[model samples]
Target: MLGSVTLLLERLGARTRHLAGSFVYAVGFGIEVARQLVLFLFGKRPAFRVLTLQILFTGVEALAIVAVLSLSLGAVIIIQGLSLLPQFGQAELTYTVLVVVITRELGPILTAFIVAARSGTAVATELGTMVVNREIEAYIATGVNPIAYLVVPRVIGVTVSVILLNVYFNVFGLAGAFFASRPTAGVALWEYVAQLGAVLQVRDLLGSALKSAVFGVIIALVSCHHGLLVEQASTEIPQQAIRAVSRCFVLLIVVNAGLTLVYYL
Candidate 1:
């Protein structure tokens, strides 16, 4: 019995130490990325091509799917709320619910999930492949800072893409809700718009924007950090990509919940 207890304690200690080391490493990685981002912003020579390509891939290419999903989600909410809320004589509350769910909560979280599944995995896979090919080594040999040349652009691109996508999501979502309400609720477009405007506060928009920015940072940092963890084996590329996506999802949810809790508090 004593031996088993000692063994369990040893295992727990090892895991705790590993988690602590990982946390420290991630923090350092984030600091370095931030420093490089500042330099990239102010430096004479910026990698415009890379940054532009990243945005094109992460944001522009993702619009169709984001639009479809947001529209469907909003329509469903409007239909359900219109059907049920009027029974309780709380029909006017539908707009408030729409603003709260589509704008404040689901908008940012859903966009982050989409970006993570798409761009997060791509970033990790691309970086891991480059690492396996020793391109990172070549960059170092050429006196090019890999973090500045490669990682910084991606971080910025993904962060910008996420924020833009979140806005896009909100717009389409609210628009879909308005249209869906027209047939069922028989409300004019202007009336629906007015109702939404009445319930939607400036703070709701600010909270949403804040959530998007924070989620973007989290996704980029986690993806890049895992991507760089790849070693010589090509097989590790997919493994790292999977890790990046999974970690991004978990972090996004945790951070979103924390932010929502803060907003309520």
Candidate 2:
């Protein structure tokens, strides 16, 4: 009985320690990424080419998927809103529903999820493979700062890409809703645009941008952190990538809820 109790205590202690270490590492990673971003703003960072390529990979390459998903989502919302809202004589609420669902909520979150599932896992896998292959050490030996050259570009790329993709998603989503509404309710384009403009507040726009930015930052930091945590063996690369993607998804959800609550309050 005593032995079993001791074993349980040991396991709990180790788990706590692991959690504490992960928290600290995440904090430090965020700080480092922020510092690098400041440098980037001043044109003091190297690897502009790398940064551009990362943006293309994370943002441009993901555009089609974001567009398709957003279009479908918006069409569905508009169709349902048009069908159901008239029964309650709240057809005008369609604009409200569109603003709330597309602009304020689903847009940023879905964009983040796409970027996380795509680039986040890729970043983790790439970095983990680099670590396993000692490429990171090779950079250090050549007197290069891996954080600035490797991590900064990726961090910036992912964040910028996610933001841009979120904007595109919103644009496509609204367009989809417009097209879908024509068939369903025969709402005129100008009237639909007016309604959307009237229903969309500056505050909602600001909130949506803020949410996208935060989600981008979270995806970058979480992916990079997990990738860097890899130690020894190529077998661990896939595991780290999986962890990065999972952690990013969970963090995005939690942060989304918190931001939504704060925005309303």
lDDT per residue (tens digit) for residues 45-122 in model 1? 467789899999999999889999999899999999999999999989999999999999999999999999999999
lDDT of 2 by residue, 11-62 (tens): 9999999999988887887787778778877877577888899999999999
What's model 1's overall lDDT? Answer: 0.92
| Ten contiguous residues with the weakest lDDT in model 1 | 43-52
Q: Which structure among the candidates has the greatest TM-score?
A: 2
Least accurate 10 contiguous residues by lDDT in model 2: 37-46
In model 1, the clashing pairs are: none
TM-score of every candidate relative to the true structure: 0.94, 0.96
- RMSD of every candidate to native, in Å, equals 1.9, 1.2
